[model samples]
Target: MKKKSTHLRALEGKSKSEKKKIRKEFEEVKERLEKAQAKYVQKPKRQKATTSKAENKKWEQKRKDRYNQRVWKGWRDKDMEEYPVKTYNIKDIEKDT
Candidate 1:
């Protein structure tokens, strides 16, 4: 069987200068990537919300007014003129309870 070469074995153990060169190259590559990323990254545009406070307040007021009008209409329809007021004694309710 053939034996492995000494040069290949020597290449497995890097010299001090070779290690330093590799470390410096890695550092340079990292710095270059950081600079390129900084240049390419973009800021997002601002978005406006759908419902502003003033519009919400206006809608809420209109809803409340509509609810109040419906309640008033029912009260008027039930009690205004055609339907006569009926009186009941409190004792009758207590007896039923």
Candidate 2:
């Protein structure tokens, strides 16, 4: 049983002084608990940032590479050999450097 419950049960048939002593002990336990809880700050909810930073960074890199592939293709020249991304792999170009 919890200290609070034990202390509460102790109150039955006790003198007024003893009841006051148990109540004081309960207050001390409450204070110690408050102190322990105050040591840690709560983190912000993930819902605020739907995606984590690393995931966002990875997605942005992929999107940039995709757009870059399209930009590399001469969009104006009407030669449809294949889509830019399918024709050239981004990682292959990066590996050269």
lDDT of 2: 0.82
lDDT of 1 by residue, 50-90 (tens): 99999999999999999877767776787785324467899
10 residues in a row with least lDDT, candidate 2: 76-85
Best by lDDT: 2
Residues 1-97 of candidate 2 have per-residue lDDT tens digits of 6456676788999999999998998999999999999889686766676789999999999999998777767753566744544566899999998
The Cα local distance difference test for each model comes to 0.79, 0.82
Candidate 1 residue spans exceeding 4 A from truth: 1-12, 50-53, 81-97
Estimated TM-score for each candidate: 0.46, 0.36
Q: Point to the candidate with the largest TM-score.
A: 1
lDDT at 49 for candidate 2? 62
